[model samples]
Target: MPISSHLSQSPEGDTFVKIRFLAACTALAAATALTGCSQLAGSADGPQKVTLWLMKGSASEDFITKFTSSFEQEHPDIDLEIKIQEWTGIGEKVNAVLAGKSKESADVIEVGNTQVAQYIETGGLSEVTLEGLRVWGSKDWLKGLSDPGSINGAQYGVPWYAANRVVIYNKDLFDDAGVKPGPKTRQEWISATQKLDKGSQQGIYLAGQNWYVLAGFIWDEGGELAVETGGQWVGTLGDDKGLAGMEFYKQLQALGDGPKDADEETPPQAQVFARGQVAQIIGTPSQAAEIEAANPALKGKLGFFPIPGKTAEKPGAVFTGGSDLIIPDKTPHRARAVEVITALISEKWQTELARTMSYVPNKTTLAHLVEGNDGAATMAVGAAQGRATPPTGRWAELEGKNPIKPYMTAVLTGQDPKQAAKTASDTISKVLSSDR
Candidate 1:
């Protein structure tokens, strides 16, 4: 946390945010109509009201309903005020809250696990000791999964849940391609995709602008976005391994059809797939539910498979997309907030989360609950091999702005991969250095 009692916010700051919110309201509402605010009431004078800010999920209401009742039974003196927020513009809203723009403080909050490092470095989250978290068994978090919340040697967030991408393809398309149930290697995957590409129907939808998706290829080639050395950030995009990864990414670009310039959000990969024209997509389990919601007929036709890395022996490293639970330093109820986080990562809650939400639980041992299902089984393998960006606040800027998108576009549109890599490395270097 910052040394100051609180980060002061001028009235103008709130007004500025309001203006931004108003400008984006129409867009926000469209993407987040399913989201709304809610709260849990407690006795006026008895227990401290600990506010919680969590992003809305499919089973959010159920999880909150059950957890709130159980939590109150366990800690009678601490009442929870659950406030659900939308993922759209959540980072900025959280930034405003941490900067003290509003008087209504959230005692406990859920932050994107990748974004957690930015908050930790910014003093937006309270420092938590691993021993303190271990009392509740949070120390049993999945291998590399928990590292997103850990910096240097200190912990800042508790692993809540993860949603990693797995290949969900149309079984009918696979049959037409004369392919097996799933790919055993990178070569086989490409061959299968090419075979699946027929008249009017495409093989895949690779969102070129999605760096999260792009990073998987980079990681598979033993490359990374950036690396810190001698207390300085360095971009690795121009390196040999990075070149190899981008070349591999370009190879797939030839086997797919979509707005090559567009992202996963603009023409949502799932919504596009729901049309039944695309054969497969690398998406999270949430998209499986979304496919059903958008076009029910496509539900039974989908098959789940883990993304293989270079060879059948190695599973590809997918982006682990999810949130972590953290307490703010300015919150009045620190211990109570700890209790809330503790309850969230508890064995019972972890199991319930997996059973209801399709999220891979934080603990590796609890992954058995997810593996029974095909997509969850594939994601279980990914969670173990998953990788996160370097632990630095500047990383948030890189993701938020996505400087690599244009470079990826350049490569996909005919520029030499090496030339694009050099340009991307230059831009990344400048971005990282400017932050310092």
Candidate 2:
């Protein structure tokens, strides 16, 4: 008998309805079976499975595979199902899943450091407290990297890896400009930039849209981007400290030392620097990997230092942004997931991941693990010593609407410094108010 004909002659004439009924029955039976099995399952695991959702593509694939294989070897009864997700529009996807609209798609998720706080605020992540820290062995795991992901004293994520900005300069360009090799004070930074600005090549190349780069300067000057006062967000970009920082950026723009508006893309900064079109750039140490991939010939010619500031005593700050591992609140296997996370952060795994990814390890001991390689160890040490900017939940939104970059664009394109600073401060105040 044909299936459709059989269904039509049966109690349900509609084939669609019959199929739906069958599916419903199957689902119910499966749920009951799983419920019964759940009662029988315990820590003396015969078989345990964990599903991890990671950002899509090759970046996470190799790491996940290697890590999972090692873990499964250690615990033969455990199995890992790795799910790769596209990062594009991930926030909306996470929101939908958290709203109970989608089935629980992930047991463990990788979140960016900047987004971790917001995820915790919305209850999207499980709370990993000081008690949870005990499970991970010690409380001493990269507290600097982990603490930023905490809210109101409860940690939401563990540091997977971190990256921070540094000053990368073309040594050939510097030598050609007759600039001495050494650290530069804030005044000397300005002077060197002016001197390096010969006709053929500019002295510096600042990314017009990079707030991370801008924040470093602001932090060095002790400027507060936003302050929580009386349970409300208040603007501080117009204050003296902020104004001083803005002035420094504006001066760089005025000197024709930064990139043009069209060159705002990160690759072009590396490209221009490699081609000797720009003398210096403020970029993350990970750019070493980027430069190698893009322009291998320019590798040995690069000189890196912690970014300079107005005073030698205070090095310019770098925005500490990196990836974090978090267990979702709805995870089915919390204890196992936590164990996996701890294993990943262990000294052995951290050293391996750091060496492979050129990322800063959360463990302090892993800082020296990448030594003798091409400047990666040195860069890690520089980042460890540099001051990190305060992270805010609304950083992404505020950065998008801020006029600091636009004002920077104007200044680089020949607007007056004072006018640019004033315009930037006004726009910053508006952005700050909107966040409240």
Candidate 3:
């Protein structure tokens, strides 16, 4: 998806991604009709087609249409077929297709950063290396996105666009509460939250069960989601450092209001805040688009800032959540597929992609594209301080299949942070070591 765009929460707290993803059978049928993708049976005598699977709206429709046309013009002998996949169960769909190494899978696929490690581990994706990344602006690639594209020593994915969480506050509410737009330090942040909680308005809203949010808290505390040493993955959250981070997260929970009952799929942060019930939300820049679309009155009332660190000069470290493109290991025209990937991340495409979609470009040098824009600017600084969840290939399973969110929710609801960390850590250790 487009920097957690697939994870968009609707006004009523529904997972909008669920609505976009079709049943596997139906999606395959539609994709077949649209792209006439092959089952990886054999090479064609004439123009070879490179199948690309992506979410329905990962990029602007206009961008995709124009880019595809221009790409075909340059590479006349090759046909680029885009097969749209749903965010829901895309991992599994890719999993099934890549299992036997047939030509049926997409030549280039847009995989979520969290899922990249697992795909690379399974030998499903071709190893997209750091040297290969040079063709796609390697020197300027965002570390948070590119790092997640690798597992062990080989890169299997290339950084696409990215998104980092930033503070989106209601300017009117903040001014009325006697607080300012961007609180530079932690103390100021807490005070602002408390003040906002006084009137009819609630304070900051942090989704208690969102693991991505949890990972950011860990990074801020100088802890990590996991660590690898001596060829083994170990869960570190059970340690003193990790426990301290979890406890800090608990303190933030006390200052915020959110739909904790919604499990890992927290209420749409933008929608809930748009109703004028919440004062601040640590949210994606794209949320601004949804907010304005639903309630036009909020356009100017909303203001954004990168969450500050302990001091004023630094932005808080955040989990770099976004999309990545990888070539399936079995792609026949690997060289041609790479050319398409290169074009997608080119300076021209990335600039327009970031501008139209409000995403952080894959390249650090492109920050100027969002220079004066508050929401985009906030995300730009955030990407600078961003980090990946973990490099473990089983990270996807650890996050989705494990009890990490339940553990965080428990701590938020009153369980001791240390105990919660210990429990979640044990599960993480098990998941990360399972494949080994």
What's the TM-score of every candidate structure? 0.84, 0.79, 0.84
Can you write out model 1's per-residue Cα lDDT over 17-103, one digit (the tens) per residue? 000001122332321232211122233555555677776552456666777666555555554666766565677777767777876
Local distance difference test, candidate 1: 0.70
Better structure of 1 and 3 per TM-score: 3
Q: Across residues 56-99, which tens digit of lDDT does each residue of candidate 2 receive?
A: 43133456566756765565545556666655576766765555
Q: List per-candidate RMSD values in Å.
A: 10.3, 11.7, 8.1
Q: Compute the lDDT of residue 409 as modeled in candidate 3.
A: 78
* Clashing residue pairs, backbone N/CA/C < 3 A, model 3: 39-104, 40-103, 128-155
Show the colliding residue pairs in model 1: none
Model 3, range 337-384, lDDT digits (tens) per residue? 565676778788888788877788887898888777778878998888
* Rank order (by lDDT, best first): 3, 1, 2
Q: After best superposition, candidate 2 residue 366: deviation in angstroms? A: 3.0
